[model samples]
Target: MSAPLLIFADTILTGFDPDGTPILLEQAALLIRDGRIADAGTADTMRRRHPEVEAMGGRGKAVIPGLINAHHHVGVTPFQMGAQDHPLELWFAERLRMRDVPPDLDTLYSAFEMVASGVTTVQHLHSRAPGDVTAVLDRANRIIGAYDRLGMRVSYSFAMRDQNRVLYDDDQVFLELLPAAMRPVAARYLAGFGLSLDEQAQVFYELRNQHSGKERIAIQIAPANLHWLSNAGLEMAARLHDATGAPMHMHLLETPYQREYAARRGQGSAVEQIQRFGLLGPDLTIGHGVWLSRDDLALCKENGVCICHNCSSNLRLKSGTADLNAFLATGLPIALGIDEAGINDDRDMLQEMRMALTLHRPSGHHSPAPTAAQVLQMATRHGAATTPFRERIGGLAKGQAADLVVLDWDRVTYPWQDSRNGFADVLVRRAKAEAVAQVMVAGRTVYADGTFVNVDRKAELDRLKKWQSRPRTALDEEMAELADAAIDVVHDYYKNWR
Candidate 1:
C-alpha cells in the first residue's frame, strides 16, 4: 500500500456549480488515501488534521480536477495527416486514405497527448475495425490494454454505424458517380468494412460481460451518428443501453448537411427522430450538436440529454459553430471534447478550453455569455457526467477518486500575481500544456516532471514511427485515388440537397 499523500496548492478550483459559478478555494490541500480523496480543505486545516501524511505540491502551484474529454476517437487525428479542412462528409473520404498503424500504438499516442494536457479521463469512441467479429473484439481489447498500461481512465465504445458509410443517404448513387474504373474499388471499400447491427450488439454484450469489473475501464455504446445508422440499428442501441444501463454517445447534426438530411429523412429534425426511438435520456450524450435548432435544444433539455462541444473539430471540419449559449440557456449540461481534431493538431485540453471560451462570446454584451469558470467546468466536471466515471471523478470531494492536475502557477500566473485576479480565470485563459507539472489518477502519479511514470512513452512512439515507415499496400494507393474521385460527388450531393 502507498503512503497517504497530502497535496498542497496555492489555490484550487473545485469546478463549477449548476448555475455556472466558480467554486474557488485558496490555500487548499487534498488528503488522499487508498486511491480516493480522504478530505479537502484549507491547507492549515488539512495539515492540522493529517499531520502524519506526506505532502506534495506547495506554494506557486494550483490544483484542479483532471480534465475530462467527453468525446474522442482511438488512434486517429485526420487533420494532422493529409486530411485537412473539409466538410465532415468530404473529410471522411480524405481520412480513408491516411496510413494505418498498430491499434495499440495509435491508442497510446493520443493518450499521452491528452495526459500531457492535464486530461485524466477520455471517452474513446472506437471506429470500425477491419476484420471479422473476433478480430474486431480483439482490436477493442488491445486498445483497452494500451490505456490500462498508461494508467489513463477511459470509457470505450464500439462505434456502431450500420448504413450510410459514404454519403448522408444511399452511397450507391455516389459510387456510380465515380469514374467507371473506381466503381468496383468504392463498392469493395464500403462492403468490406462494417458489421451488422446484430454482430455489433453481440460484441458489446460479450465485451461488457468480460470486462465490466475491470479497473478504470467502462464500456458504452456509440451509434456513430444520426444518418449513419438504420432504424433497426438504433433500436439495438436503445436495447443495449436499457440492458446494461451503459451510457450512449452519438454524433448529432454536426454539419448543416446533416441537419438537412435529418429533416428530410425524419420529416422533422434529428433530435425528434431520436426521441421517437426512445434513446433520449440522461444516459445519452450527443457528441457535436453544432447545427441543433432551438426546438432541438429544448428537447434535449427536457430529456436530460447532454452535449459535448468539440469546438476545434467543428472548426477544422468546417462544421458550423455550436451555439453553446443556447444550450446553456436551456439548462442543458455541456461538456468539452477534442475529438482528435484540436486546432493545434494535438490533444491539448487547455487549448480547447481557451478556444471554447472565446468562440461563443456574442458580438454585444450578453447577460450570460460563457465564462471562464463555465469552460473549466465543461472541461472537468460536466464532462465526467457523460461517462460512468461521473460519481468517482470530476471533483476533489471526500471519497471521490484522487484524480487531479497540478499546474505550475508561477509559469501561468507570471507578469501579474494579484490574488484578486481570480486563479480560475487566469488558469483557463493563459495556461497551456507546459503548465501541467503533474497529473494523478486514482492516487497514483501517472505523469510528472515532463515524463510519463507508468509507461515508456518514447519507446511506444518509436514503435509507431517504425510502423509508419513501412510500405503501403495496393489497397492504400487505390483508396487514395478513390477518395479523391469521390470528394467532388460528395460536395455536389450536399450542394443539390433539397
Candidate 2:
C-alpha cells in the first residue's frame, strides 16, 4: 500500500451507468489510498477536504479507467516471427515457422507495448507448447514473473487442446495426406504435444494452486476452442470450473470453417455442445464469436455468458466481421480483445477502439453503431468481468482498484476543438499511445512520459535482437524444412474445405 494521493484531471470519465453510457465529471479529482479509490469529486472540493494529500495530474491531463485487453496471445506476434496473416486455419501452419523466444523475454516484450498504450491488465492465453507438466509449469511461471516485474495485472491460462493439433481432423488422418517421407517428420512433430486429457487438467490445477495467493495474477482455464477439444476435454474444462470458481475463456466460432466443423460434429451448434457439458454461465467467456447466430447469442444471453469481440484480428485474418450490432441488441456482456495482434500488428487500444467505433455503422442513416462510452465500457468494465479480477480492477468507484490512464489533453484535441463535441467521442477518435502521459495500476505509476518505471526496455530489446541473430540450430533447420513441406499440404486440405 502506498501513501494517500489525489489525481486531478481537467476532465474524468469515471465509469458507465446502468444504461451503458459513460459517467463524466469535469474538473474532478480521485483520492486513492492503499491501492483503491477512496473518493471522487470536483477538484476544488477534494483539495479543500484533503489539502494535505499529495497530488498528481493537474491542468493538461484527462483521466479514464485503465483499459483491458481481454484476449491476447504471445508477447511477440507470429507476424513479427515471419508468419504472414493467413486465414486462421492456414495461419496455424505458417505459425510453425516462428522461431522460439524464451518465455520471460517474449512476455516482457509485449508488456512494454501494452503498458505504453495505457493497458493496465491483460488476459494472456498461452498456446500449447511441446512439453510435459513440469516444462509447461515452468513456462507459465516465467510469463507470470514478467508481469509481476512490470507491475501489470494479468489473468493467465495455458490452452488445453487434446486433438486437432494441425487441422480440423485427427492428427493421423491429416498426416496421411502428406508424402511418405514427410509423414514421419510430421508424425514426430505431432507427438511432441502428447499431453493427455488428464495431464492437461493436472496442469490447470497445479497452476491455480501455485498462483492462488497472488494479488496481481490469476490462473484461469482455457479449453482452446471447439475444434481443438474432444468431448472428454470439454467435460474436463467444465469439471475444472465447477471444482474451483475460476472463470473459463474458450475460443469458439471464430471463422466460417470453424462453424462448418461444428455442424459436421452432428452435436448441434458449438454453444449447444458446450451447454450439454454444463459449461455455459457467467464465468465462461467465448473468444472471437464472429460466426455465432442469433440463436447462439440468445442462448449465451440466457446463460449470462460473455462474448469477447476481436474486431481487428477478424479483419486482419480475413475472418468476417462479427455481428456486434446483433450482440448489443441481445444485451450480452461484450468486451474487446487484441488477439494475436491489432490491425497494425501492434497493441494500441486507442486505435482498436476507433476501429470498432467506425466498423459497425452500416449504410442506413440511423444504423446502429457503438457509442464511444460503450466501447470504453467494453475495454474496461466488461473486459474485467470476463476475468477473475472482476469488481477489483475495472472502474473508478470508491473501493475499486485505482487503475487508470492519464492522457495529454492538449495532444488529444490539438490545434482546435469544438465545445459541442462530447469528450468521449473526441478522445476515442484522436487519442494515441503517444498521448498517454502516465499509467497507474494499484495507485502506483508504472509508466510515465515515454518510459517504464521498472524495466530498462531498450537494453532488454537489444538483448532479444542479439540472441535471435544467432545461427539456427539443427532442430531449427529441421522444423523450418518441415514447416515448408507441411504448409502446402495444409493449404490444399483447407482450399476446398467448407
Candidate 3:
C-alpha cells in the first residue's frame, strides 16, 4: 500500500463502508499510501496530508468501486450459446457436460469482457473435466494469471456433483429419467456447468494443499445436488468446510423440479437439508434463489446466508425471477450474478443490472422498478459480503483493498437531466462496455483506458481459438460427449417450454 497515490475525479462514488453510500467528493483528491487509502479530502487537505505525493491526473471522470461479480462459470465456450433458453435442471446438466472441453480462449474472452465492462472481482463457479484436474488447474492458473495482470479479485470453486451417480447407478434409468418428450428439448439446456465430485475434491485438495497466497488461490466447495449425493458426499462437503474454513457455494431453489425432488425424497427443501448438514452461514453463498419462498429467504437472513441472484439466467432459462422485493423485505444479503456466457450475450454485468431492472413487469401491475443505484448495491456491496473476502473488497473506501473503476463520462454523455433522465437512470439505461475507462485492482492499474496489463491477450486468444477448433479424440470424448448429447436432446425437446 503505497502512501499517496494521488487520484482525483469529477465524482468519486464511494460505497466503501458497510452500507453502500455514495460519497461525492467533488473536486476532491485521494491519497493511497502503499495501497491503503491514507487520506482523502479537498485538494488542500490531501496536499497537507501527503506533501510528497505523486499525482495521477484525471478530470471529469466518474470513479466507483470495482464491480464484484458473485457468480460465473469461467469455461464458457462460444458453443455454449447453443442453448438459448431452458429450465433449471436441464440447464445445469447441459452446463456440466460442456465444460473445459471447449478451448481455454473461449473462457478467456468471456472473462475479458467482464473486466472490460468494469467488473474487478469475480467468483468463478467453475467446472472442469474429470481424471484431469491438473489440466483444469493449469487452465485456471492461466486464467488467474490473466486476472492478476488485469488486477481482478477472483475466488474459484469447482461446480460439484457426486450425488446423481451415488443415488442411481444404472445407465438405462438415467436415460429414461427425464421425460421422453423433454429429452430433445433439454439437449440445449446444459453446457459448462462445473465439475463432478471426484473432480471437485481433487481440485479442492490440490488448491488447499498447494496454494500459497491469501489473494491468489482460494479454496471453495460446491455441492451440486442433494439428491444425487450419498451420505458420504455430504460428509465430504462438510469435511471441506471444516478442514479449510473455506467458502462453500451451490445452486439452491432455482427450479420447481428441485423442490419436487426434495419432496419425493422426503427432504423438505434442499437448502434446509444442506443447512442441517452444516452447510449454511457466512461462508455459504447460494446462487439463483429464484424459487425460494419467504420462509426460505428468512432462513438465509437468519443465518447470514447470502444469495447470488442471477437475474438474466433466471429470465432466459424461464426459471422465474428472484422476488427481489420479498428478499429485500427479509433483510437477506443479495449479490448480482451473470449466469455463465451471460444473460443476453457475453459477460457484461452492466447489461445484467439493466435486465434486473425491467424483467419483473407484471402483466400491467405498474410499479416503479428498482433503480440503477439499487441494483448496483446488490452487485458491489451485497456481492462482496457473500464471499469470505467481504472484509477486504467490494467498495471504494480508504483502507479497503484498492479495487475500483474509472468511468469515461466524456464519451458516455449520460447525465441528460431531462424530464425522464436522472444520472443514475442514464447509467443503467445507456452505459455501454465502451464507457468503462480504467480498472484498478489491489492499488495497481490492471486495465487502463481499455488496455489490460496481464498476458498478451491477442496471442492468448489466438492459441485458445486454435485449441478449441481441434476436435476431441474418441478416447477422450466418452463422458462429456454423452452429457452434451443428452443436454442437446433435452433442450431441443423442450424448445417451447410451458
**Which candidate's lDDT is highest?**
2
Candidate 1 lands at a TM-score of: 0.97
Model 2: per-residue Cα lDDT over 178-243, one tens digit each: 777778778888888899989988888898888888778998999899889999999999998999
Error of 3 at 397 (Å): 1.6
lDDT of 1 by residue, 64-160 (tens): 9999999888565775557867878888877777776688999999999999999999999987687778988999999999988999999999999
Q: Return the clash pairs for model 1, or none.
A: none
Candidate 2 whole-model C-alpha lDDT, 0 to 1: 0.89
Q: What is the lDDT of residue 186 in candidate 3?
A: 33
Number of backbone clashes in candidate 2: 0
Give the winner by TM-score: 2
| Ranked candidates (lDDT, high to low) | 2, 1, 3
**What would the C-alpha RMSD of candidate 1 be, to one decimal place?**
1.5
Candidates arranged by TM-score, highest first:
2, 1, 3
Off by over 4 Å in 2: none
